[model samples]
Target: MECLASLRTRVHPVVVSAQIASALYDTGLQMVVKERCSDNSTATEEDRQKAISNFYMTYTMLSSLLPFVPAYFLTRYGDRGFRKVPIGIPLLGYLISRTLLLLVILLELPIEVMFGGAVVYGLCGGYSSYWAGVMALESASSQKERRSLCIMGIELAYGIAGFVGSLSSGHIFQIHAIGNKNGVVLVAFCIFLYFLCIIYTFFILVIPGTSAGNVEHRQEGNVGILWNIVEYPRSCNIVIVLLFISAILYDIAVAGGMEMLMSFIMKEPLNWGADQVGYSNAAGFVIFFTSFFGVWLFSKFVADAAMIMIGMVSFAAGIYFMSFVTATYLFYLARSLTLFALIPMPTIRSLLSKQVQPSSYGKILISLQLSFTLASLIYSPIYTKVYQSTLSWFPGFVFLLSSIITVLAIIPISMVGWRMARQEGYVSIEGD
Candidate 1:
């Protein structure tokens, strides 16, 4: 009973539930967009592809663009002890947005109405506040030595949930609740799951007080400081700024490639059906597992930055390989090369958490996430446009572009590692 209570209080359940709901919602939206764009009697394949891609880019814009202020404020409050506010409000947004998708399916409304749903989602804080809050909580709960593992474990839970949800998402999209209608049941279940997430987060979830490791660090006044090189009352922390730039660049590479990968696989030689889409999404989730294990095993030998670089190389090689994949098996083969791709971001977040005082870590994380949202706003449309223009000439060009950018993203991390080595009193994270 004590163990059961402890388990219930942990955040893993919330991560699992929310990710499951997200998988269903994403698959539902994609299929709906595909159906609608392809329904026009005179529309060619390229026209359907362009239309679908346009909707996604626009939806991503609205969902990401408006969250900057609201998310900042939400995490600001979260940092000050209104912890649940940041998390609960975004779940509320998710519930509302998901409900809109359901209504679109049930009422046969124009798919463009989802743009409003994205606006509501962004205004309510979107992923920036929610993930920042979650990371802050996780960071506080774990010891410094175990922080990376603890956070990676949360990601593992998220990935497992996504995998299970996506594995069944396609079949669920075809299931009808009352009448024989597509996506009604799937979106309904997504709403139901978010409802559970909200309830669990608010009523049952327990926010842990600071763990001993972070407390000890707080007590170490200026002794183990990583950013001591920066003068006091500084205009900006250069290391943090560099970290943000690195994270955003990596996010651009990942998001741009994956966003277009959806449209790419949906058309032409692959022409993936709903089941294949489910399988492909499930394949993507597999990286979380691999990355967690990579961190666990690699941490014993290599530094955090090295682990991040390893992950980046894995992705760079894989995405570049993706540029040549002409068959479904080849696509999966390319994906297989990215087994460690998810490692870099979480490791980067862990590094960020350690750099700040506990009281101010939430702000830093939210700043990073908001920057990622901003990057998505800029890159989504560009990747879409590039994919459309190259559709006839070479559809996989964007993947190659992402690979090059991923390689570029590595330089900043290498700088950080070199700086750490050059700094006195720093262990440089080469081992242990």
Candidate 2:
């Protein structure tokens, strides 16, 4: 605690400087409103406040949809093209669509039109990961060193991108506001700007890396949509049971904790605005990027299981501390620490790749996606209920539940290594 306090004393000034600059920009927007509209006697203060609140809610709902649909699309179609169109083109389409939607938020587009575009954006964003995942699986060697490094590099790059993306959002928004663009126009323009990045990614970043391999496409045969869950119970290796359960527990912990943090911890208790969510999220991404680099550096010394255990400990501690935080500094610290929990994800995914036969790689990835989707659906709604009902008491409940679940997961994950060793006859455990 003392060390954390000392770290905060050193770090808080930097965070404060950035946050203050952002707040000043928002303040400037408010000043624009004051200056442009003389007295504006027609619009009551309550009316203006109501519009702002509604816009914020719409944004949140749209953002949530962004990740889910895109992931599903990508999972289903990332490797294959539509009707012989180059797969890259459709992927480009998805990215462009998402860029437009994100731009909507950045440019401050009309809430109504953006609400529609957001749906498409969410779907494309989800799909991007599928392409990346397929590429990783195809390229990585089965050797532990090569696979670990490959997964670590991808995850580190992703975290760095996310961290940078967050910082960029604030600056873009500030620029738009300073130029006197309305919400709708500003957001549309922002989308245009990001779409350029997507185009570059597709043409420049993605093209060279992709190739038509001997990878077999899934049979579009008699496999029913729902039956895929139970029918392919063994689609993954026997160790999948452990991975499934662990993924569920970890995601549950994450979803529940985030609900507590955003809905209650920072906003309701601390009396902060929506923009604070963006800043805090950026800070978390920075920490997550740092932890991912740690995964890269320590890949040789760390077993995937050991890294997961460390992540769980950090997650539990972060959640517990978050539940009790009263100071603003503590909130930032808790969020930063919690991102350490995310560092183990790519490592776990790499382990999953190893457990299955090489022939079953695509199927296993699909199954993993299904498992996580089901877990998220089951967990998020329940967490939402708990949060809404208890209000201030919710964070503690969510954190405690996560801690207990992590404890339960320990034994199962331990058995995973043993199970893998029995199948492969060669133990890939760290220090072996």
Candidate 3:
């Protein structure tokens, strides 16, 4: 009875951790930028832009590159017996990183030291393993028919928590009670929250019995992980492959575009303060809720592939609008236009989940994560460099490029839709 109760009460720690981490990382990075660039009265605008760009690039590179191996092992081995290890390890990494940030602030250490923190975090599984664990747990626990809703619910929880945390983070950082040094109070709160997540994940959370054991018998063979990777694509249908590719492209475009947006808002025409940054981030989180609603509403009548196509169109339009953004109101307008933008990735994930066998969830998610990380490896440095080079002439060029990439994402999604229709034996009528 006690075990059943625990299982009933289980909620993924990633929800809270993602929220707190987003708030802390966003505000914390801003503080780092201010200290590195603006704090020196002698620093020129060019100096500040270069400093911020270099710091973010270094952090992105390290964070994305270091996690691949550990994350792969965690996801692969996790299916064997150690389910919680994937979630716990990343949470531990988060704790260490947040602690390091606090110490960096209180001890007046160099902002570059945060690179070490990123390394520690990445080595422990980072976002890839953490999120994959969350998805795997949800996929295992919920009925197949309800899995899509369950995943979307998780995203909604993550988004709402992020919205609340971001809304308050700016105020928390500005609190004068913690001395004149910025982000001390905010970092302290982050540390406390991370600590709570670690405790709850280690002690309280439970995986339900339904998905607890390795139901799919692996007795057929002990093919090594490398062989399994080589076999994965050959095993999957072309539709699944295209779906995976579409998901990867959308993620890369969104990530690269947002990275540029972060740096963009910090500079010239819109020199966003911490409060403005908080509000902007809050607005971004609002998309999660809006997207959830969009998915729920659209799922009633539209095919998943069609829904994804709509989302891609919305995102492309939003990015196009963002390219012309000069005022804060226009920024908000651009965000509003993308309210349905959050739909594609989750929908793509849902489509992919439906295509795979139950036992393959961990492997499939790991593949998706690897693709996302690989895309980051290519896009982050390129986007940062492009942003820096065009800082004086066309800062919005990245957004235009993002819009183009999103439009291109529509191709694979369209193919998936056509495949689905054919599989369903539905004949297309021209101008019907």
Give per-residue lDDT, candidate 3, residue 343. 86
TM-score of 3: 0.91
Which scores higher on TM-score, 1 or 2? 1
Model 2 residue runs over 4 Å out of place are 1-115, 121-144, 176-190, 205-236, 357-359, 392-396, 421-432
Candidate 2's C-alpha lDDT?
Answer: 0.50
Sort by lDDT, best first.
1, 3, 2
Residue-wise lDDT of candidate 2 within 2-87, one digit each (tens)?
66544332212222222333233232232222223224568654343334333434543554545554454554453342111222
Q: What is the number of residue pairs that collide in model 1?
A: 0
lDDT (0-100) at residue 290 of candidate 1? 95
Q: Could you tell me the TM-score of candidate 1?
A: 0.92
Best by lDDT: 1
| Residues 1-432, model 1: lDDT tens digits | 999879865889989999999998888888888888888989888998899889989988888899999999998877666567788899999999999988888888999999999988899999888899899888867788889889999999999999999999999998888567899989998999999999998887766552422343444455546545445333126667667878899999999999998899889899888888988999999999999999999999987888889999999999999999899999999999999999999999998887777667788899899999888888999999999999998999999999999999999888877665555234445443
Clashing pairs in 1: none
Per-residue lDDT tens digits for candidate 3, residues 1-432, read 976675445664557665766676677777566666777888888678878877888888888889999999988776664567787898889889878887777787888889999999999999899888778767766776666667888888888889988888877878754457888878877877777777777676665552343433342145445445654344247888899889888987899898788778887788888888888989888988998998889888988899899889989999999998999999999999998898888777777777766566777887898789888889999988888888788889999999999988999989989878876663345434
- What's the lDDT for all of these models? 0.87, 0.50, 0.80
Candidate 2's TM-score: 0.66
Give candidate 3 misplaced runs (Cα > 4 Å). 1-9, 12-14, 177-179, 210-236, 426-432
